[model samples]
Target: MRWAGRGTEPEAVERFYAVIPAGGIGSRLWPLSRADAPKFLHDLTGSGQTLLKETWDRLSPIAGDDRVMVVCGRAHRAAVEEQLPKLEDRNVVLESEGKDSSAAIGLAAAILEHREPGVIIGSFAADHVIGDQRRFRQAVVEAVAVADAGYIATIGILPSEPAIGFGYIEGGQKLDVPGTTAAYAVTRFVEKPDLATAREYVESGRYLWNGGMFIARADALLDEMAKTKPQLVAGLRRLAAAWDTPERGVVVDEEWPRLEKIAIDYSVAEPAAAAGRLAVVVGEFPWDDVGDFASIAKLQSGGRGSDLAILGEHARVLADSSSGIVVTDRDRLITLIGVENIVVVDTEDALLVTTSEHAQRVKSVVDALKLSGRTDVL
Candidate 1:
């Protein structure tokens, strides 16, 4: 892997720790992604290994088998452990409840900082699909170099299209960090915009899709948390101080619930970017967050103009002059004759039938089910 530097400065080769926060329910990808068994537990890519396992495999080469940590919910602890057998019990940080990305990542960082003062920690999601492993690794290496220079570095994926679903990161002038090329100062972070704004951003070529991947020193991350969210930092510090002690469970149970529910993007990233304490490394690798069914269809179809796409094993799907996607977990044939641009998710207990255009609104269905007291399907 080639890396760009200012001069002949030696590359920062330190022990890197990868902290994966695997706590999302992925409500949009319902049926397949449920409360008891979230999306990360299933092999959405049909690669035999689950998404959590894939994440572990992807990071193992860089962080070593032992240095990689996972922060997940208490309910999914068994599943995470089953998928990642190499992960130590100590390395699997458990959250009492879902507090959001900030708490999950901050807790992991605090524990890592306590274990090793200067450990470089990179937070990558458990459900993201990353193509071109070499390019992804190259970007991570560069991000680590930028992080070593004491900036919270993020990998900003080069936008492939004007997608209104993902946020954007506006990049500023390039930084003078050594052993890096394409490291830029982050101008600002923008939320998911309308199609018109997204088109403008793509045409301007100054924005990158926010991939939610961040790399920085454990201490640096904790320090930023201290500044932006002092209460969160205090609680995490208390938990980290007791992480390996006998009172760990008691401390977490008492403190975790009181921590504010906030995302890392809002609690740290955006604030840090505003204060000129953030850097973005342009990542051109193919990446997808697999947010909804439409994204899954795109991945399965290989972005081809196929009228139909199927995701799952033993799915005897037969479509005639129809354009849609079908996912089946049952042992039966699914026939689509004339439906166009539809999405059919067939599970044992629940089957979801909706148009692909409404893929982003599947979360509403989840909410409706909750209101109707249909927790069995949820």
Candidate 2:
């Protein structure tokens, strides 16, 4: 596998444009990352920078402002507008409704296709956290170069641990292509595995975490889409044809609801892999999807301490609060004397107390609350 480092130069990249698909409601990270404010807007890293801002910062050097586009749902228009003041009002493509990743990418692709031909596109989720931004950027730069050569490419994360939360890519053998630093022919893409299977994948040394990062020319993607999932591609093509027309953007909002909800991974990458048409590039950069609260617990002190006061553990008395996450709601005293493995969320009107282990299942509670018509709790 190929590893990347800061400022490590690769082959010159193609004309690059980035599409960030951020339509998720983030029900899993409820108290902090709500439907109104998803995980991308929150400071999950404890670094004071939001996930989308960090992603924008890392990608800015390569694609720059004019080429960077954000695809978010209508519910988050104001929040996105407030956060990214530099972006033009039109650059933010507001989905009339939230369908899924397939529709989001299709919308972004339609925009890019109209803007420029032979454009290399890097589409990624906004909430994922990449540790080595420079290396990550370098790896993307390399992937763009590979894409320019007419192959659908994705950045496959080298499995650092037996992570059950992530999908894995198998059958990634090193390639001997010219001017290629590290490209692999993807044998297959596996969905999330059981613990035993995950352990085997990590130990096998032939698997990589499917980090859900994709790169390819817009035309190449459309071509693959046409070949693999023609119905979805046809709908997107119709959308692309009418994206810029005055009547389309303002009046054709109804058509989007009819669009199929599919993921780029399922519709494009998996088929390509099965047909031996997909290229998986080994990425050296550290990555995480940051899906739910359990991941949050892992990020904070490896979820070890109950009395693990994040901001001020040593200064104050934090006794018998072992295995509790004491996130202060206000600038008040947060002394947890007796708590264990609970997530203490301090929101304005809501306070959630959930065990760290079952934090990922919080979305079910949110769904149930919605079913009960209790918008007050949600």
Candidate 3:
């Protein structure tokens, strides 16, 4: 974990860092994803392990347990530690408050740079699910190789559909990287588009869903931040300097609140792409961020019954002429009669009933709850 000079180690033997940014409430999941226990802490797929733990499992083989780091809020530090017991205490970077992804990932990059020069770091979200582990590892390996060549690399998931929920990356010329077969120069990063635009993007075959996975040398990432978000870079560098010292907590408490709240896309990736420093590796693996309840249903259904999906093990669902989705954490029997395209989420304290089409609007329920000052349920 000490700094060896740049180019001292071979590309294969060089250290690669995996940074997990675990700091979202997942409001679209509503009652299931709450303030104390977020979506990342739950096993949405009933896989027996939480999403955060699964993320760690996926990255530990590529980066090793010692090199993997998680940047999360101080409030959820205990939960993160509980879920990932094998994670070293020092590898968990705690933010005093939520300053968004730019601060989270930039601080992690700055700290990693301070620890070891010429280190490659990849930032992945804690709540995403990857179906093909082999393809995921392959994509990461290619991304790291591209990063080693002095470019900011990202894993661009091959779009299986015209999804308007996620952003898109337009790839330009194909790169001639040695290890990767489908590396491309990133032309631009576009936001989530309308239905017609998404259709056009998919039909054109030049676009990939932006999976939010970014890889780069720690020094390079910090340098990019220095150009676009100089003040954040300065603060992160200052905090990183004191990271291992006794004043770490004091410095973080003082500096973290003052940092600007911005996302890494706006702070670095977009600007860097415009400056011709971004590269992307095509990730053909099945990937989903599980943004809403409809996505969860799709994941659980296995495409067998698109009209009806059940999401819990103990949910004794009796559907008679009913079709849609039902999710229950309790052991009680759930009966649906003559219902169509409806969603029923039964928890101990909260019950959400809506249509499958309105699954994306669950966040509105959370907003109304907040407006009513119903912190007890929220």
TM-score, structure 3 vs. true: 0.94
lDDT of 3 by residue, 239-314 (tens): 9999999999899878988999999999889999999899999999999998888787777776443567877768
Task: Please give the range of 10 consecutive residues that has the lowest summed lDDT in model 2.
Answer: 1-10
C-alpha RMSD between model 2 and the true structure: 3.8
Would you list the clashing residue pairs of candidate 2? 306-322, 306-323, 306-324, 323-341
- Residue range 1-378, candidate 2, lDDT tens digits: 122232344343437888888887678877666777787887776777778888777776677666678999888888877776666655788888786887788667766876787788889888888888766876787788778777788888988789888999985667655556878889999999988999999899888999998898888888787786777777777776777776677444657768788888888889888887778788887788877765666666653443353422222334563664555435545556566777766666777777777777888988988899987756
Supply candidate 2's per-residue lDDT for 262. 82
164-223: candidate 1 lDDT, tens digit per residue: 989999999999988789899999999999999999999999999999999999889888
- Please give the ranking of all candidate structures by TM-score, highest first, separated by commas: 1, 3, 2
Per-model lDDT? 0.88, 0.75, 0.88
Error of 2 at 330 (Å): 3.2
